[model samples]
Target: MSTTVLHARTLPGDAEQRWPARLWGVLAVLCLVVFLDGLDGSMISIALPSVGHDLGMGTASLQWIVNGYYLGYGGLLLLGGRAADMLGRRRVFLIALGVFAAASLLSSVAASGSLLIATRFVKGVAAAFTAPASLSLLTTTFPEGAQRNGALSVFSLFGALGYSLGLVLGGVLDGFGWRYVFLMPVPLALLALVVGWKLISRDRRPRPGRRDHADRGRRRVR
Candidate 1:
């Protein structure tokens, strides 16, 4: 049997019919990361009572498990953006994905509310980096206008659908243990890490513009 092969759209800039196979793979990985991020928050919401029961959490502190994640995620948004710029988007994304996976593993086995909350915070922090980096990477990889718009639509659809699916998944996994909710994302993260590593292109950064020139000019004048 002969199999037909489809070529990928050129990595950003070519308005073409067949997209690069690697581009689709990269999009899947990026969308998976976002999907898991959205799912983690929603899925855990359904498991809170179970978590509280197992961890012996008080009402006051139980809220923090969720809030802790938000705190780390929201607070670090700016820092994560800067990190993607300075640290390199692909490198930062991979590191953050690892952090998210590790934190999920830690969260699954946490013996105390303190530990669980801390792990959630860590996951959220990782998410902060992953979100922007994924978006930046996606846009750059796809061409402007229709191509980028289509990619964004797919990315956002995953995010929206993840929340919906998470609730159902949370209920199903509840039979196993609330820990499964946190534990589940770990595999997805790992898979994304692998796919991303293989498919993500090594991008050359554009040079800094007027800021560098101005500084050099002043230094030379002095």
Candidate 2:
């Protein structure tokens, strides 16, 4: 007697079918958010001379202005990722974006160099939350397939573009005023917030019944 071998076949889930449109929109918003993040990261560097001259910042204070933001951003990244997993990525992303925008506005209006630096620190904290949430949202939303690969590629390209564009935009805005350099992200961030809220699905915890059903289905398939 000849035995036939059966190859295991994996089926696409409901999320794979329903989430593509929403996922695309979310991807666009995330790209923009990351772009703004990259822009802000470099913009300050280009505008530092003007900022120091205008605010009459000494050398030590100038170093702190940049160092503070870096320290804050690095310190909060892991915590932010955990928060996104616990609180839900979309919720955290929106909240972070809002915080970032508010901080940017504060930096724009700050009266002293110290105040502006403080706002930059706050912005860095907000970015820590935004960056991880944005990426996590994309990963969770898309399933493993050509689609997911394409989405990630696009996301990476946007990040790189943002980094490069930051220098150019910084030069243009810095020519106007150092304040413009800080204020530039506000509108884009607002737009990203609006798009993200509209496009990203709320992260729901898996219900017990759903988990049980999945387990039962797997057993039956076996």
TM-score of 1: 0.88
Q: Each model's RMSD to truth, in Å?
A: 5.5, 8.8
Error of 2 at 99 (Å): 0.2
Note the clash tally of each candidate. Answer: 4, 0
Q: What TM-score quantifies how close candidate 2 is to the native fold?
A: 0.83
Over 109-203, each residue of candidate 2 has an lDDT whose tens digit, in order, gives 88898898899999999999998998898888777886778788988898888889888998999999999999989998999999888878878
- lDDT (C-alpha, whole model) for all candidates: 0.90, 0.86
Off by over 4 Å in 2: 1-21, 208-222
User: Candidate 2 — what's its lDDT?
Assistant: 0.86
lDDT of 1 by residue, 84-118 (tens): 88889999999999999999999999999999999
Q: Candidate 1: minimum summed lDDT over ten consecutive residues — where? A: 1-10
